[model samples]
Target: MRPFHYDKPATATDAVTNFRPGAQYFAGGTTMVDLMKLDVMKPARLIDISGLEKGRYDFIKWSGKSLRIGALTPMTKLADDDKVRARVPMLSDALWLAASPQIRNMARIGGNVLQRTRCPYFRDTSYEQCNKRKPGSGCAALDGGVTRHHAVLGTSDKCIATYPGDFAQALVALDAVVEILGEDGPRSLRFADLHVLPEARPDRETTLAPSDLIIAFSIEDADFPRSKYLKIRDRESYAYALASTASALRMDGNTIADVRLGLGGVATTPWRAREAEAALRGGPATEAQFARAADIAFAGASTTDENAFKVELGKRTMVRSLLETARMEG
Candidate 1:
């Protein structure tokens, strides 16, 4: 990594003051350090924001009604929290489905959301043609690639990179909110609205400005009659998702009262299948209804050559997730 000054701030004000034109915050240093070593993140100064009392990973605030997780909270802490497991179990399971134990130990909850993409050409500049890594350089994945893992929901001619994270998927499903601190003061955003699709500019991924710092995340909880996260990857452990779905259902007798869903591994962002949710709402919870609902979610998707598999896989995965969440009592 290039030479950089280090500052450790104890307060949000201190952290904001330390932000300069070309500086980056250092939290767990798992993803940041990896990119720094690769020369992709060459910040002139590094502000260490790992330790703060109000900033610690605080899962104890979680009840069945509300949940708040601190920014500096380690992924390990979240994956092990009993409350997270019970209320939003899908969120906890997504953390467990990420990297590995050791990596998770060093990865922070906030940093995980801000981590860069897994696009090969972007990660290694030797390709010299990833528009997202360096705009106007052009996208290699667009013309010369087998983009099996690329996006089917959100894509542009410039970049079709997938948002490769698990936690955000469940966050979208539960309608979570993210807490960010900035010079303008703290503000909250619906987690589903945080990420931007590749409609116009594929270069940018989120709404966060340069000087903003994430503090915590809150998810409102209801006794969603049932919910589940179903992930399909090449392997069971230590692998990125090929397709995944998060679904929560409220059932009344043999009918569906309400439905919530968010999809991953097939879109440019946390793909919220709102249409699917609508289709299932006030309808039966049978396999056919679930399948139809899943179909509605992707009716507007535009597929590419290699990632067309995602559409079918996504539909099937959505069905399985719904079935598990609905419990489908006989």
Candidate 2:
């Protein structure tokens, strides 16, 4: 890692004022530090914002109508929160299933959502053709590389790097809103719109401005007691998802009153399956309906030779998640 200046700002305003082109905000440092060691991210300065005011952006609160989670809140804290576990079990499950105890203890919710892709070519500096690593450059994974872990959905000719986070999927499914504080003051955006598809400029992953600081996430309360996060991976634990789904449902007898779905591991970003949710809403809550919804979810999936199986796997994962959620007592 290159030498860099470090600054710890106690307030959000100060952090934004201190932001520069080559400066990066330090929260959990799980992603930033790892990328810096790999030489994938070289920041000239580190602005430590983790010590910001606690009540402002470092606490989790449920206001009866919605859940507000501070951006700097540790993953473990969120996972273990009683209210979160009871009300939004899917969010808790997503956090618990991610990384390990040590990582979850150190990783922050904001940084987790903003984590970079785990594509080998993108992380390895030796590979000079990673479009996400270097804009306008070719994508080595697309040409010839180990692509079983790459994306099959929301992919483009420019890049096929898979999003490698769990919490974002839960947030997307719950229709969370991301609050931001920037030079222009504060604003909020849909969580689903935070990440950008790897189109022409794959290097530009998120819609966040350089000077913007993620403040918190707001998720509206709903009758989604029957919710789950199901992740299928190569291993039983401490592994990234091969195919994952976050399923939340509200059933009126045997009919689905409402549903929300988010897919991970097989997509370029935290993919909200709006189409699938639409198909399942007000429909019979059954295996057949779940399978049909899954089919619609992966309908537009594009894949390469090695990762093509992800389409089927992702669909199956969604179906299983929905079925499991449907069986849960709400």
Candidate closest to the true structure, highest TM-score: 2
Q: Put down candidate 1 lDDT per residue, 1-330, tens digits, no spaces.
A: 789898887787788866898888877898889888888778988888887556554444757588778888889888898766776677777889888899899888898887777877778868777877677888888878668878788777778888888878888888889999988999999888788876556667889888898888987773443666788898998887888998887778878887889898888898888877877888888999988988898787677777888889988998998888777331
Q: Give residue 168's error in model 1 in angstroms.
A: 0.2
Write model 2 residue lDDT over 25-57, tens digit each, in one string: 988898999999989999999998888975467
| RMSD over all Cα atoms, model 1 | 2.0
Q: Look at candidate 2 and tell me the lDDT of residue 115.
A: 90
**RMSD of candidates 1 onward, in order:** 2.0, 1.0
Local error of candidate 2 at residue 180 (angstroms): 0.3
- Which prediction has the highest lDDT against the true structure? 2
Output the lDDT of residue 215, model 1.
Answer: 88
